[model samples]
Target: MIGKLNHVAIAVPDLEAACITYRDALGASLSQRQELPEHGVTVVFIDLGNTKVELLEPLGENSPIAQFLERNPTGGMHHICYEVPDIRSARDRLLAEGARVLGDGEPKIGAHGKPVLFLHPKDFCGTLVELEEV
Candidate 1:
């Protein structure tokens, strides 16, 4: 089962501009940009009091974010992550309930260094959902 809202991920065409918007205009504290080659993204976390905002920029041409950007050049909310106590169990339950998991249906290390899995957008009312173990 899902727990607290972990973070909302946004895909951006310009990582620096997005970081500046959150850091300077919004007065938010942000982490240094981290390249997650495994996930094919370069990310920066914007610290919000209760939750965080994840900014994602495609790391390579094959990156999923690149495809997303191709669909929406302006970029937008890519996914919403929710915390889970047990990722495997949560995945199993989702599978049994006929929900589709993205990728190989396995958990991968996320930006927070936590196990994370992405659910198919179509399965969650057209919004991609990410479950991160905490």
Candidate 2:
């Protein structure tokens, strides 16, 4: 079941520059930053009140964000992640509804060590859907 609205991820080419804008300029504090080699990207989190704004920078050409950035030259919001009580069940529900997954099966390592699965945006009205177990 989808629980809470988690952090909104924004794709950016420069994580450091984005962090400075959100932190020093916008008054949001840097929460955390992590590099996921498997995903080929680096993420920096900025706490904004109760929610967090995540900045994503592609580590290489194979990174999902790299493709995103290439398409959107301005670099904007990439995807929204919703917290779920049980990711496996959530994914099952989505798949039963004819939603396609990027991977063959099972949850994968996500930002902040969360287990996550994605539902094809095309099946969900072009909104990229990410399910994370909190």
Candidate 3:
């Protein structure tokens, strides 16, 4: 099933400003900005010792992050990702247990360049859960 806490994603209005806040103000090292057109987000990763924090900015109007921003103008936690030994197996288990998977219920390439699937928020205490194959 799920393994270690992979990363926590935050939807932000401004990617640069968020990076600056984490870099200059919080003394965190930021990774290079990566634009994921397929997922519709431009992201920056703040590397913490054990886990990473992902800052996401909408790449287009249809981006999910954009909708999230519309709800919380100042931005907020978008989702939390957990590592999985095998994404397909984990997905099947979740499906059998009656958990809804987002999108087509298939894994897509995620920010980490790994196969990832997002579970429905309502199925997980209103918190979006992402499972990444490690």
Model 1, range 1-134, lDDT digits (tens) per residue?
Answer: 78899999999999999998988898999999999888899999888989989999999759978989999888899999999999999999999999999889989888778999999999999999999999
- Candidate closest to the true structure, highest TM-score: 3
**lDDT, each prediction:** 0.92, 0.83, 0.92
Give the per-residue lDDT of model 2 (tens digit) for 2-87: 77788888999788888888888888878677887788888888777777778889986689878789899768988888899888
Query: For each candidate, C-alpha RMSD in Å?
Result: 1.2, 1.5, 1.1
Candidates in order, TM-scores: namely 0.93, 0.90, 0.95
Model 3 residue pairs with clashes:
none
Query: After superposition, which runs of candidate 1 have C-alpha atoms over 4 Å from their true positions?
Result: none
The reply for model 3, stretches above 4 Å from the true place, is: none
lDDT of each residue in 50-129, candidate 3, tens digit only: 99999999996599788789999999999999999999999999999999999998899887789999999999999999
